[model samples]
Target: MDMQMARIGLFFDGQAELQRWSHQENIFERFIIEVLEHARVPYQMIDDISKFNTVDLLIVGLASENHLIKEALLEYAASGGIVISYGGLELLSQELGCKILPPLEAGYLVLPAEFGQEDPLRYLKANPWQYIDSESVKQTGELSGDDQKSAALLQIPVGKGYVDRWAINIPETIVGLQQGTSPVTEDGIPAPDGTANLDEGILKADDGFELDWEKDRKTTETGMPYFFTPYADLWREVLLGHLTRRALDKGLTLPVLEYWPAGVQHMAMISFDSDMNINEAAEATLQVLKQEDVQTTWCIIAPGFSKEIYEKAKVDGHELALHYNALEAEDGVWSEEAFLEQLEWLKGAADETNFTSNKNHYTRFEGWGELFQWCEKNGIQADQTRGPSKKGNVGFLFGTCQPYFPISLADEQNRFYDVMEIGFLTQDMNHPSLADTTIIQPFLEKAKRVDGVAHFLFHQHHIYHLPKVKEALIEVVRKARAAGFTFWTSKQINDWERARRTLTVSANGRLEVLGAAELPDVKVWIPLADADAEERGLTYKYGLPGKTQVLQVQLNKVEL
Candidate 1:
């Protein structure tokens, strides 16, 4: 028998229960459903008020409150059922002792001038409205929520159940509220006395209400989607990158699982594009990488090496990935077959088995998709040879500066991969010949366009040629950090996505691949922060443990 876990009972408040919910009119409700689905908590909809008596989880739409449901809800909570209410349901939060993200709206927000008579709010005295927020809605603008500083709580075991409050502003608002983008506060009011921060000095108005600077100085409010996108510090604070914290709050269920931090557990992959380069010349740079305790997936050409060279690279902690020449393809060989050979050759030296991770070999574009498949076949965990940033026309496949799905290879059912892309934002910023920070801004800007890992790409050879590139790269990292994005390794990112899933052989006997490949016995040596994919060893075999068949392999230096 499979383990029976938490199954929540849902109860609608009086109002929503009676209306016979015509369909999720609010996309916000649909999004909320997605988050709950992502969380993998078992729940069922309860429309018939008569069957609500044993509801394990009660969801009361704000407008759908009723006397009978309210009484049942009180009894359910007192009897120990979980009650989750939202929107107008916030009354439950106050009554049950909690709060939701405040109902806040920015003065800078561009609301529509036209309202339809058929809209939900049009049907009632209290009007209902909807708006879509940018992925970075929190940054660049002010958090113009109502001054409701009320805290939302999840009270466990009151009577036979519990209660949790939610403030819905479409699904992304929750993300926005959490990401420091625009949030929907309770009461939808801005601070009457002006935006107050006890620390930073904010400009004020005479009557004490915050002045609408965005309104007065607005010439082009249309370009920036989020209301705050124009504010410099706010933009930096919210838009620069990843949602490391707010994402965690919607919650990570295993209360005590140790965080295997990408900051410490990830290895940044660095490779130089051109080189009839020498190992000795590369020594100083490699030494610094080692001295700094960083590991590298050092992309090298086969032309310039002797035994001592490989020994030296090994000594300095370098894992070699092949950077081949396109013109030197074997006569009559299809590019795919040629790339396969190259992967084999690289594997011989570096031995990354069954991991689909590779970069370009001489910036070749032919059959790159095949190359990706080839890498996948050979155990390359991920393939990163999207294109040469400075040189090729990175055919808009994977995506801009974010770890995403190969446009053609996206897992359609997995919405996350529906047009995904990620970048190891590698480029020599300090080169006098390089366009400098102005151009750099776009790449960083590219990262803020969506939510995916920004794995920066930089060359150790450039650092060897000019130390300033390293400094400039560090500055880029700082700016990205200030923008709230987390620097991560390819593997670390893979792990983060992997960790977010829960594999359940559902009541219907379905195997769910939560977020990634469900590789249980697969031993992958995850590179440490200071160490990356320098050469590692691998071994594979089959076995039976606890009456289950499994394949086992060990990655020499990587640890999950």
Candidate 2:
């Protein structure tokens, strides 16, 4: 907190046409007020332009026709003050100068958007018109209807100050206030109505927009608004940063985590199969991901994937995997007959490189090394080839859903290779009964409690046909982020190893890791190389996995 916090004057001419665009909850005003508070940027609502002299930030809420207020805001900008105007700010942006040219149209944020003019009630929550590349919008990640768009230019630097114009009001500040986050998110629910399906949009030409509420899935419950207060820790830290920057001496000591030597304490891996559409999946799949988004490594890819498909995807910042389904031949790559045959086939399939890591199709046999003894030796860092999961939940005992390597040598019983095993947390997500929101929540809770990483195994076919699942996966990442899950790609891991410190501490010393590696003290529970599972099989018959690690850390823990 600064003694000289920002004195933001929010100009609200009672007749501003912006008022006519009142959000479901008067979100614009709520957002304006909240940003000032959360950012610890103190502000006031002004009804008259005369209230300008003492303010550091002037927010003018203009009616599309409020020419007087618009000009005044320009004057404020020229006078070297922050001038942010919404609602009719388009005219000012073009005549006054800004970056985001007004959009040709706009629409309200809806939960499950309406689709099919024929069957109006087909509640699909997205529109086909949102230009994937909207030059003006700044915030990234997921976009929803509530996030207003401006038909006007979104830019800064009016005269001496900066100007921001919006066609629709975005109450991110208010939503953050209620949800305790500056970003739009519904953390826990995988598909909990307005939460999981979060988005925000703005007003545009109006001609290109269409929203038939009677057919749409709907917005949040009137009382339980889609947006709520965000967390306080972020605001506190930011407030302190600004206060310190202003040279405002407040003796405000804030807790901070600095210079993370080993980042990403946790990570996730996705499994692919022969069905991956390398050529066409980029735009539909990889491109749809949030920008600078969380990264993931693909496993079990065919050798054919590397040449053109993988290269193209790599260009778009996507990772590749061996996608080894050598098990397609019932005998698996281990048997002398299977291994020799599979190895020869794979080696000649393509020249880029052998599969980095291979997975048993259906997990019938995950020992991919049979085909190529150089799993870790080659470059394969992780293996996600476990359960697509049968009726009950499943996982490697002693192994957490989070990434961890088998620290022991592979033996006859449980001879898992030397890479990290990302056990299954959820699968068949597109399957009917599995899509229930109720089911996903408890699963997530159990994951948090039992070191589950919300392991999701998505196939391209699943994403192509079931867009909702694609949406769910997004929610999964969001929830994972909220629950302190740090995303890590092998590259990030390499980054850590590259900068790692050679500890000179005593042999018994240890350190904790968080995010990618939990901190305070990082203690990874390495599974025993082998667990004599013949004498220790799961109760009943591969019974339901409880809050316990399903497989012992040892190789023998996995009953062959």
Candidate 3:
């Protein structure tokens, strides 16, 4: 027997002026929705509190000082509806027999061992915690600061339901960690004195690398710049787990749609940047890919291999994309015109009209959100530049192994860019230090833990000139394949992710496959919430022990 799925309602106060929820202030809303979608948790957005009685779980993003919202929340909880809220403690302090205290700027949240978290959670930039003191409030976690009285995680019972509140603003901290604390300025990090071969100032990818070395960076024996602790991903998991537990508490099994198709444990993608664009060099990498029986993405440069070679690659099922060069080549320049020119040249060279993915030459990036905007302007669906370029900066430096749509702090009404960012783990794994399994295995394992894509970048030029690089490429392919990882082109990953976003599960266990054409092989795991599910011939898998048994269903079978 299947239990009715939990209905989640995200309450967004519509009176923007009252709460200052302008485009600038709406990053919280944008990021929270992104997190829910990425986690495959379906939610309905409600602006009015009248609908609060409908959803089983209500996520209050910001209650601000609205007394009406507070009153409605109290009534909903009294009527037995779970609430997860952030901020707005002052209005409810007196009602709940609590006192509000001063908020902290940047702090660490020491999650209790009950949550199975070891390291203290770090919020790079915070939006002021809603410090509260109440004897009735059960503190699951506390702030690791001078103020031992303050609680980081609070669970307060109202009438029948409970309200779980977090002192810190999760959205702001996650946005800051993922896309730098501040906007990327041209003068953010000065280029080396003689490295400026051009008269004009050009921004590179390094200028935008956001992880703080002092607090966030993790060092390894390999001596590579590997941020072992995925701070952003970890915080994301905490929120998801807390939500799942709350659903379970309400006797509902929260269904999470797995990231990869057909419940694949993990997936990997290998992309080769055509630096020299030599026919022989490109063919060399293709030969290795063919041996592994994998289809990979090729980021091609201008004047790429002969048309016949590209045709052969196309026939062999490889994605041909642009390798935007803004480095030292003659066609290289850091201007929109130059970007379009190079993109057009590569498209023509590959005998294609539009390419779905691209990577900047040298991982060249300048400024914030400009490249993403460019990707949107073109037909490009995904980007592969947000990774380590040098040997030192190799694994999880940018703090994620998943493909995500970058949020533009500048955009009004829409903060998220359409183009997806498929960040690679390491580029050119030929260096002796990074080439070792000791360095690579951790990233691969972490991606599996998070159900993220482990992207690896190898250059065509290196594969041809360096025998070590070729050997390393083969080694990674075989190892990842043996580890139950399937290789996909960037286009396939982007297409699948976008299509699955439309998938929805009804309260009656009916799966809605909106993009069935694009999701032929997709699978969904719907939990069997009945106590006697196994006795009725159902199976239990996923989640903790004694959790609900889930049955995997083919997505295409139930078309919306």
User: Per-residue lDDT for 1-560 in model 1, tens only?
Assistant: 12222344444333452343344232123233434433334456665666655544455433344566556667766765555543345434345533344244432221112110111110001111121222311211112233432222223335644554323232333322211221112112232233212112211111111223233211112221111121211211121111111212222111111122222222233444425455554666656655555555555554534456556766765555555434434232335676667656655654344332455543334421344455545555554555323311111112233333331111221122221122344356556544243334444443443333345556656766676876765566556655655544444444444443332212223212222233343111111112223433421111100111122222222222
Instruction: Give the whole-model CA lDDT for all candidates, comma-separated.
Output: 0.37, 0.38, 0.70
Ten-residue segment with the worst summed lDDT in candidate 2? Answer: 114-123
Q: Give the winner by lDDT.
A: 3
Give the per-residue lDDT of model 2 (tens digit) for 270-366: 4444445454543455654534275655543343444555555556554555554444343334344553344345555443454444444544432
Clash tally, candidates in order: 79, 69, 2
Residue 500 local lDDT, model 3: 73
Worst 10 residues of 3 by lDDT: 190-199
| Cα-based TM-score, every candidate | 0.40, 0.37, 0.87
RMSD of 2: 25.6
Better of 1 and 3 by lDDT: 3
> How well is each residue in 1-560 modelled by candidate 3, as lDDT tens digits?
34567889988676742345354544454577888888778789888889999899998865656788889988998889988865544566666665566666666777866454567777653222332455666776766553545676678888998777777667656666666666555533422332212223545565555554455555456544455656677777777777767887888866666677665658899998877778888788778778878888988877678898788788899998888888854557777888888888887766689899989987777766778888889888899987765554567666677778877653344368898888888867765434444556777777776778888888888888888878878878888888888889999999988877777644455543334344444545454433463464443323322332233433465455
Q: Of the candidates numbered 2 and 3, which has the greater lDDT value?
A: 3
Global lDDT for candidate 3?
0.70
- Alpha carbon deviation, residue 550, candidate 2 (Å): 33
**Order of models, best lDDT first:** 3, 2, 1
